[model samples]
Structure formats: C-alpha cells, structure tokens
Target: MDRKQIINDPQTGNKGEAFEAYDDIPANPNLQRTIGDVIAARYGRRELLKGILGVSATTALFGATALSAPRPSAAAVSPEQGRYNFAELQWGNDETHHVADGYDADILLRWGDPITADAPEFDVMNQSAEAQLKQFGYNNDYVGFVPLNEEGSRGLLCVNHEYTNEEVMFPGLGRQDRADFAGMTRELVDTEMAAHGGSVVEIARGNDGKWQVVRDGKMNRRISPLHTEMTIDGPAAGHPRMQTSADPTGTRVIGTLNNCAGGMTPWGTWLMAEENFHGYFWTDKLDEDGKPDLSEQPEAEQMKRYGAPGRWYAWGKYHDRFNIDKEPNELNRFGWVVEVDPRNPDATPVKHTALGRFRHEGAETTVSSSGRLVVYMGDDARFDYQYKYVSDGVVSEDPAANARLLSEGTLYVARFDEDGSLTWLPLVHGEGPLTAENGFASQADVLIDTRLAADALGATPMDRPEDAQPRGDGTAYVMLTNNTRREADQVDAANPRAESSFGHIIEIKEAGGDHAATHGHWSILVKCGDPALAEVGAEWNPETSENGWFGSPDNCAFDAEGRLWVSTDQGSGWGKTGKSDGLYGVETEGELRGHSKLFFRCPVGGELCGPYFTPDNETLFLAVQHPGTDGTKALKGFERASTFEDPATRWPDFDPKMPPRPSVVVVTRQGGGKIAV
Candidate 1:
C-alpha cells in the first residue's frame, strides 16, 4: 500500500519515510496528480445504458463463454516451481516459507499462545501493557473460517494483525522514535495495539486432522484498536461528521485500523476491513483555535480522501489523542466496515455505518432468496472507488435474525457501463443526486464524502479495488491494484489504461443472479500485463493477457476447486524495467490452461498477504508480513534482520534462534492431491 505521496511535507507528511533510517520511499516526485483529468473533465459523458441493460441481460443467458473460462491444465505451475524456488525460506526464527514443496501439514501460531480464558503469555523480553492486550497478538493477517454446520462440522478462526513489530514485537533491538506514552508504559504501545486489530480464535480439528488454535476456546476474543467497541453503521450513522464526546450519537466508533483483507457473512458474521485507516491519526494545526490553519478543511479534501488526517500517527511525542486537531472524531473513527460476531464473544465490534469510509480493502458477502444482502467492497487506495452495501434490513434466514442485518444497510456506488456493465449507485438517504443540490447535505454527507459522493454519483474510478472474490457462479472477482496514475490522456471506458503499470481483474455479472443487483455485467475478466510485451495485444484489446503476467495485482482468492490466487503489489512500470513481487496461481477452470507461474517470493522484506483456502480444499492459510523489514537498524541474534535461516525453512518447528516471526502458516495436501496446482 505504498504509492501514496500526498506530502506537502509536514515531517514527510505523517508516518512516511517508513519510520526513518535510510528513508527514501515517499518520493512523491510529483506531477502525477491529475485527479484523473479533473475527474474526467468535470463529469460530462453519460450513457452506459446500464451497461447496455447489463450486457443485454447477461449476454442472452451466459453465452459469453461463461465469461471466458476454459484456460487451465498447464500442470498448474510445476508443483510450485518444484517446491519453493522463489526464496525467503527461513523456518527456525519462528516461521516463514513462500511455500516449500507443495504442503501437507505445516503449523505455526506463535507470538504468545493462549487464545483466551483471558490470553497473555509470550514475553519477548518483559512484554506487558495489559499483557499485550490479552495475547495471541503480533503479526497475523486475514484468515477466515466459519463452518460449524452443513457437514463442514465446526469452526470460528478470524485472524488479522496487519501491523506492528518494533524489532520483532518489541523489547528493543533498535527501536524508533521511542516515545513510550504509557498506554499502559508502552511495550511499544502494547505491541502496537496488540498487533493492530483482529483475533476471534476458537478453532478445533486436530488429532492429526489439522486446524488447531483453540487454546481455551469458549469463543476466544481480542478486538483492540486500543480497546474495541465500534458501532456506527450505514449512511454515516449519526453524522455530525461522526459526532462524539464518546459517541453522543456519532454512532459509536473506537477501534480497528489497517485490519486488511476480510469477508464472511451469510448470517454467520465476520467482515473486517479498515485498511490503512489513514495511518492512525495525528493532525493538530492548533484547531481548537489558539490559531493555526494549514489550508484545506471543510473536511480537508474529504479527510484526505479517506486516510483521514485530523492528525495521523504523530508518533514522536507519543500519545495524547494521537492529535487529530485534538480528536476530530479520531480520524472519523477509522474507514468503516468492522462487523465481527464469531458466535458472540460478548459481541460488540461494529462500525458498519453502511460501509462508506474508504481505504477498506475487503467485505464480500452474498445473500438474497428474498433477504437482500450483497456486500462486496474494496478501496485499497490508488484511483479508488468500487463499493456495494445494499441492506435496508432484509436478512431473515435467521441465524438469529441474520446477525441483525449487518446493522442496517444501503450504501452503493459503482458505475462502469460501456459495453461491460455495472451500476449500483445508491449511497441512500434521499437518493439520486443525494441533496442540498448534489453537494450532498445529508445521509451523513453521502456516507462521509464517499469519494466526493462517488464523484457526484457517477462512480467507476477503479484500478485499485484489491480483492472481492465470489465466483462459485455468481460472479464477482475484482482486484485491480495497479494504476501508475493512468496517464496517456487519462484513459476511460471505466479506466481503460493510460499509465497502467500492471493490474486488472474485474468480472462482475450480478443482475438476476442478484447480489441484490442495482445493476451489473462487467468484463475484462483478467488483464494483468507483462507477457514479454508487444503492446500486450493493444492494451488487452479483448481479453487474453496471461503467461506469468507480473506487477501489482494484490490480494485475491478462489481455491476450493476454482483456482485463481494472484497476489503481487509494488509498483513502477512493469518490466519495461524492474520491480518484482510474487505469488500467482491462475487456472480459472478446466484443462488447467491459463497457467501463470511465480508462486512465492516476498522475503526481501515481504508483501504477499491473506491467501486463505481450507474449506476441505485442504488447509493453506499464509500471512508472513515484514520479514527482516529492510529498513534496517533492528538486528540481534545472528545479526537479525531475519530470513529465518538454517537448513532453509524449518520455521518454529520449535524455534531456532527467534526473530523472523510474523507467523500463521498451515498449508496441507502431501499425497492428498489437488493443492498447489
């Protein structure tokens, strides 16, 4: 998620220079922001005929070759390049493996064990601050599981620790800024708010059957964003720009940020997604008025387009309302969609606020047999806007009233319709051009300036949705992640490339298959560049763009006999030069054709997150964040800055000199067949 550069330089514009040392990343190197040609020259082109009435009502019933399928069977990537040739193998320092020889039994859950009965154990040298907020925390991103019925038999799991690791979960090695604000005397802000939000735990399966992590179960918990409560749902719940005084009806808000890639809700409940909740607030500029101004406010360009800066992580002096002009509703209580119920562990982790707050990166769902739910979200940054919320409370398949219909919903906003289709649009509360004459004066200002009211209700500015998944035949699959600010005359027809830099996945469909359809029928269905170019067939003229395609395409899923794992995110022009990050599994059905290789790399200071699968498709979890964090200055035991080390990936099969732990691995399938294919 680093291509942000909006820096007018307030100390490298908040948390930039990746917390110091040999900095050099935020090179805004300006001249990029054309806000897409002043948003398509002030929105002037219209007719997408609801994308030709949703591709003439589903291309005469699925004629569209089930939207291009039949591309697999190329030996689905030689057993992951003959078991891990993408490097980053160290297993001793707790855990790390970009997959070693096609799986079948692998485990690592470290960083304190317990899981609840009031968790708290792993020490890493003295660690505390209320026992790292009831333990089992520290690096572990997006893991999902629910099962418990329909023959799936029993589950709960949930994970998501997307941040934190001051020299391996604290107790010093090199430390940064060193404030120690006493959020209970900083065990580094209690291991950065107990490893940034997420953990439901409760699992169970073992006795050599796999699954594990139920330590003391009873629906284990831990929702921290510094103590979790989170309520606020839909059209900015009680908006006065999300009022407060501890929620005097700004609709409750307190916890969750950077909780990355999530989903799961058909009445069981989970849905987390608060990606980069704007680098945890810190904008002070003396606002309670002793006098200071700092240009831009009337919601500073809509809270800096959802990376809110009523202040953001001013880490140096430590805490004191991490200064958002002294709490402008604490960065409007973090980019929404929180949910969580994992079978009620005292259930109170909300913030659905009709899913508008941006920078989210996850939310998928699908319901309706006349209960109308359909969620699907993603706003991972660069070029943003791809949402869906649809729920004015209709859920009645009764899982206790469909977990209170995700606190009532309606939010929409998506528009791409030239030939391909899609049209949701409704950010409700007085719909259609929402009010105060379009500048939206209500519905909590169209869900907190939802990308400037999806740009006065036109929506469709993609190339950065980052994970939606769905296709068991209802179609969804989004991802997008690359848009080097699309130049070459701003390109359009729903982001037709300009300065693409590799990224595109789309798919859509909706309408009668109804994910509570407002409209749908998109295509492109896959167009990630780099196949040893040749103008990549006139910029993906009409589909086919596969062969080990590279560059930015971040978080994706679809494993249970569906195949399509693609992960990769880091920018710069795609191989018209350098830059490379890995992970890919493309086989979108049959004969295993569309084979794209490069299965796992990350390690040079990683990035390949949330790749779940286990629903009997046999295990395979994976999260491995920031290994030897390549910013240096945090080294120890064998010059730490880890790679896990020794006889390659043995990873916490019981320690080998700790310090490389960002744990969470379970892969499976050895002789079980059908995995890593």
Candidate 2:
C-alpha cells in the first residue's frame, strides 16, 4: 500500500476519503511487547484455518458461545427475545433514511438552516461566514441535549459540525486540496471555517410529539473557528509551547475545529472533543517529494507524532496560525476536549488541557461510585492508546465547583495485560516514564505531548479506539473501530485479531465496581463482521440476523434502559459490505448477550453519527453526516465523486436546487411511545 502515491494522485479517491484512508495507516512504529503481541501469546494462537481468519484462536478470544450455533437469518430473531424489541430495519443503500416500522424519523435541523431568531434564510448560492455563524453548521456529528425543563420537553441541542465536504459545499469549487486550493477564496475559506465547530440551539416538543427547532430560543448560538474566542485551562493552559503569534499570552486562542463525538456533563455543560484536528492545517512548504516540509520546524518530532499540518483543507492558506511553518505551536492548541456552558451564551468555552491532548474521539463523562467525575475517551487513531481522566474532586450541588473538576484531574492511559486485566497508568508529570528524563519537563509537557508520553510508558495500542461508553454498573465499553494494518504477530488479548477490518468491541468491568479504579477485567464483547463468512471471523450471537451484523463500530450509546445501541462510520470502506452505515441495538448481557438488531440506517454515501436518546427514551436524535459524498463511486450507477452539481441523492429535501444536506433527525415511536418498545 503506497500511501504517498495514493495521496499525490488527484484522481484516486475524494479529498476527505483519501486523507482518512491514508490516516488509518498506522503511524506508530514503536511496538515492542504491545497489546497485539501480548494477546497472541496470552490466547495461544493456532494454525490459520483459512486466508482470512484463525478459527480456533478467534473462538478462544470471543468465547465458544459465539459460534455454538449457525447465525440465524436476518429476520430470525423475535421481538420478545431480548431488551431491544423493535422490528429490524432492513439494511441496504438507498436515497432516503429509514427506521423501524413503528417509528418516525423527522428532520429537525439541516445545514445552513436558521438557528438564531434573526438569522437569514439559507441561500446556497449566496453564503457568507456572517450568515453561517447565524445558521446551522455542516456535517453534524455529535448531538447532546441539555434539558431546560424537568420533564425534558425543552432542551438545548449541542450538535458538533465535524467538517465540510468542499466538493459538495461550494458550487464550482470542485475538490480544492489536491489542486493546491486554487479555487478557494478568502470568503469561501472563512465560510468553511465558520462551519467547523459546534451549534447550540434550543429545541422543544410540540403537541404532536415531534421535535422542532426553537428559532427564537434565547440561548441559540454558534461557535466556529472563524471568530469565536476561547480560553485555555488546566496545566497546559499558559505553556510556552501553546504561545502563538496571534495569542502571545498563550491563555487565549481562536475557536475549536473538527469537533466530533462529545458528551454532556451532569451539571449541564457540553464537552466538545476536537478529533482529527491535524487535517485542517496547511503548509505551502513542500519537499521535492511534494510532502509537507517540516525540516525547519523546531517541534518537528512532536508535530510528526501528532500528524500536524496535514493540509487537508485550505484554511491555513487564509489563516496564518494553521500553517505549521508560520505558527507551529497552534496545532498544540487543539485536540483537547473543550467544555462549553450551553446554558450561558456569555460563557467563554475553555479547552481543558488536563484531559491530555490526542485525537480525542469522545469525552463521555460519568460519575464514579465514589462521586468523582470519570471521563472515558479514545484516541481515534490506528495504533493509538485509550485514555481516561479522573477528577481530583467529587461532584457537589454547586455547579461552579464542579466546573473546576475538569481543570484538576489525573489522566491515565490504558494497558491491557495477557491476564485479562486492565491497568490505568497515570500520566502525572513526575510519574514513571512521564518525567524530565523522557522529554516531559512539567505536567503541561506530559499533557501537551500525551501520545509521546504514553508511548514511553508502553500503553496498549488498540485498533482505532473511538467513543467508549461507560455503564452505570462500573463497566466501560471501549470501541476498537478497525485496524487492517495490524499483523498476525501483533494480535493481543485486548484486540485478538490480526488484520481485523470489521473491528470489535471490548467491555471493561472496573474493579470493585468503581470507574475510578485503576484496574479492571476486560473481554471482547463481540467481533464485528459478517457472521455468514467464516473466514471473516465474526462473533455475533448466533441470533444476530444478516441485517444486524455491522462493521466499523465508531460511536455507541447506552439508552435509558441500559441497552447498547451502536452507530457505524465505515467511510468509503462501506463498499466492502453491501449494507449502509446504520444504528443497531446490541445486547450486552443475558442469554442473548451478543445479539444485535438493526434499528435505523443512513442514506447512501452517508455515515451514521450521534445516536442520542432523550432522557425519557421517547426520542432518538441521529446525525447523518457527509451524505451523498463518501463511496459514491462504489455505488453501481454513481461511479464518480459526488458534488453539489451531481450528487447521488438529494435527501431530506429532494428539491432540484438543494444538494444533500447533513441533518439532525428526530426519531419517535408512532403514536407517542418509548422508541423500539
């Protein structure tokens, strides 16, 4: 796999798809007795039965019950079998979204839709940063709700605008990254910048049980990289490395970008995680090979470790800070979880550096049995480590004191052992490998170069960890999306597969029923892929229907009933499986423990994200991102890159003038009942 060649070619894959595929290629070459090596030794490998998988070794890891019986047909499971009681939604690629039989998937908000009261109507032909700041941003990923009332009838929806599809965003600016951003102007780049953060809008339930955007909602606001000012907090707050030309003080910075999967604090604060922040940076200085020229950078080693100055977008062409050659430290400002008070529009969002900077996929927070705030996070990169932050202080009735919790915490990276035990290695400044001897001078340095410090400590590198959801019973589910780059010798007990393309889920049971516990027991919940293909080594419950089995499990949510629902982001790789990215109900316990059922699916070329269920569980908000853009070339009829002019499907609004817009969909059971009941 020649990544450099693939990246240099403009006609290969679309801009975002090509970059993501390249990024998935493992960057870390420092594996010694890492997770995969430990797993193969711990599990005792057997001879490969077929070219695709090791049957005996796989069964040993996922339990003999996984393959006790042949997989049932797609419609074999009955509704009364497990906790999830919805009829499975048939899986396939299509122009429109679909849900289970008794539910209604309503479009609540679309990109460029007016979010504030005085915002102008969406006009695709005439877009400006000014208008975008007042409207909904593009490619919504994370959807979190902060209730305004006790019944949760009214709440603020905090939706993250992950990124923009330049090919489908502008009318004539067909892919710009590969062309050296020749078609992008200052205004167009500004608009893209304005659409990169998160949107906070108040929504209410009407008499008909449908969720509607409250246009006049007092707290409606947009946070964007264009102009929104933010402050740095925690140990790395005012570090010298964070000081940039624009903000010499180092305490202040511009808005956040690439805000992906996030979580809501118990006190009503929204935590937006900056994932893949490296891709937005740009640099004109290229070597003879046409790769980013980082030879002049002072922090070249650190920059390469974190994948900075990727030049995926043209933002740095217009903004000096995004260019590594001009302002190298600016890349360090992002990749931390930014906490925002959605209730107060005047509140300045703070980037908590104590969380330890990396490609933070999700900041799912929960209160430990001891009352301390425990946040489960994934690095969201192949061969990266999973991390958790335990606050020093416990929660109280006062929201102000709880806000201080994030600023002062001990961050730890996971190290899964062959003994089926998980150890949380503290990343404190003076601890273990995170000391002055290993380039970490202060706590700030450890937090800033978190990946480097974790590398020194020999943290277990799992397969693209993303969106870990911790349960109330002190159990945490860590999602290993996929890592086809992993070899047979690298397989570990935590991730028991080599060249695992379909990915798997690992359930962590915190010791002593305390999430803040430094140790726990870990096991593979399920190995994701097609159970029908024995070589693929899928390990779903035999009852998992053909439509139920899924791949590339990215984001997951535990509903009010404690049932696990997963959403996938297969990206351009969705072509591997004929099924479109969708949401599925997965059983975590009982006789039907590993059973899964399809609940909802996204439109063609779209990825399912933010499957957030309301407090009452009556409604589920699903964000369909990058619709009609990814993998369109794989679709039989549409064998080309999708643009605004030639989209695979103009979903939500089939209007001839409107392109397929990423939207937030509200799902409710017909006749007003709990979803999937």
Q: What digit string (tens of lDDT, one per residue) describes model 2 on residues 371-416?
A: 9999999999888899999999998999878989999989999998
155 Cα displacement, candidate 2 (Å)? 0.9
Best by lDDT: 2
Question: Across residues 1-677, which tens digit of lDDT does each residue of candidate 1 receive?
Answer: 22222222222211222332111122112223222332232222221111111343333323354345453333333344332222222221112444545454355475566677766567656666577666666667677888766645357778777666454444333333232222223445545776678887766656565667767778777787777877776556776767756666787766786787888876667888877765666554534331224364566656555544422233423554455555566566677778888888887877876677777788877765466677888776666678877676776756766665766667787776555556788877567677878678777777766777776666656666777877645677787766655556555334445666666676777877777778877664445665345443112211222334555677777777666777765521222323334566654433233334555544434455678776776666666555444322221233233222322222343355455555666666555544654
TM value for model 1: 0.32
TM-score of each: 0.32, 0.97
RMSD of 1: 23.5
Query: What 10-residue stretch in candidate 1 is worst by lDDT?
Result: 21-30
